[model samples]
Target: MKKIIFIFLLALSFGCSESDSASNDSTGQGGSLAVFALKDNYLYSVDHMKLNVFSLINGEKPVKVNDIPIGFDIETLFAYGDNLFIGSRNGMFIYSISNPENPTKLSSVQHFTACDPVIANSTHSFVTLNSNTTCGNNTNVLQVYDTKDLKNPKLIHSRNLMQPKGIGFYTAKYLLVCDDVLKIFNIENPSEPILVHAIDKNCFDVIIRDNTLFAIGDKGVYRYKMNPNDIKDIQLESETNF
Candidate 1:
């Protein structure tokens, strides 16, 4: 378990490889229950089904904070500057995690039938929907929303993606979509989203900073510096994804 956690933390904090996640759990389903940003001191984890938070004062047992009852599973979470973006079948729950212990759920948005994960910026948020039931054809989608107003987040764009599982945002310019195909979008204009390129190989998780893209796939850690002219072909950086 320690080894796994260390690896995860490394993949997250550093530019190890393509940053993504996969389920090795018994149920073949593992959601990101907790996350702590490099800039923050406290740790935030989720109890998926309950949508409840587990806050750690230092690195101790997680203290129960908030409860979000979303029937399915709250698969992923992102701890941004001041807010906590939660993803589940219930909807996207935006909570203020500034007060670690007393997390207040500021708002909720039920846009898709199944919103399992989220990636965001100060002005925008990106969510992924993977459902076999209400989600037609089990097709994955990328839904962008305006989060300038936390109280009421408005939908900006919804585009279909293939095997979309996880996501992350970086540089405030690109939206990294993690799935069978790792995608990077030129979100220069939220309303007019352009898919500049994608690497359809092994990226399951993505973390980016400026032109540098880090992915965690079956290959382990993959790093690349994306070409502005051609995103599909990126300059490979030092990685252990072999």
Candidate 2:
């Protein structure tokens, strides 16, 4: 159980890949739920080599629609506007979901074998690679890319991290990274992100809604009240053990 917690912590803190249509922005609202992503009336799931598509038209029950074969060791899933990002140990894959039932591959950026999860808004995407027992011989760093062109994502810059896990966008201006510690950065300038504040706490993943921040780690579920005026003024509202 301890081993599972450690692994979960590592995977949760980095970032998760996502996909969604522009019409439905609420599907990928939280960063912590990485395994599954929703777009319109469909839900996509990844398990090793297969991308499973399910229709939520019935809402209560998921109807299996299609099973698309993908690369090995798929780690996370994220839904951006009209696009789905798949994070495999080998690289990042982007898919167009104009037809949610049948997603087509647009492009992919290959990287060294590592544990990676990605998150993005409309313009930029963030991917973090972490070195772990499962991820062999990989350097830990945060890679940022310009997603202006869906077919061709350009790598703009990268920032080295100790061990990055789940990442959250507080706004277009601020980003939260969970690793050995919780670090928030001022990304007003996406190309040059500056670390504004950090907490000496081990964190796995985080999600921000309105003015509240939710995070989970070995300690348990954590909740905080966020102050946009001062990123450093985050107040711990409550905590519960798992």
* Regions of candidate 2 where Cα sits further than 4 Å from its true position: 1-24
Clash counts for all predictions: 17, 18
Worst 10 residues of 1 by lDDT: 22-31
* Each prediction's TM-score versus the true structure: 0.73, 0.88
Q: Give one digit per residue, the lDDT tens place, for model 2 in 94-184.
A: 9888899999999999998888889877888888888978888767988888888878999988999998988888856888899789998
Best of the candidates, lDDT: 2
Model 1 ranges off by over 4 Å: 1-6, 14-39, 50-72, 111-115, 132-137, 227-233, 239-242
RMSD in angstroms, all models?
A: 7.0, 4.5
The Cα local distance difference test for each model comes to 0.62, 0.78
What 10-residue stretch in candidate 2 is worst by lDDT? 13-22
Count clashing residue pairs in model 2.
Answer: 18
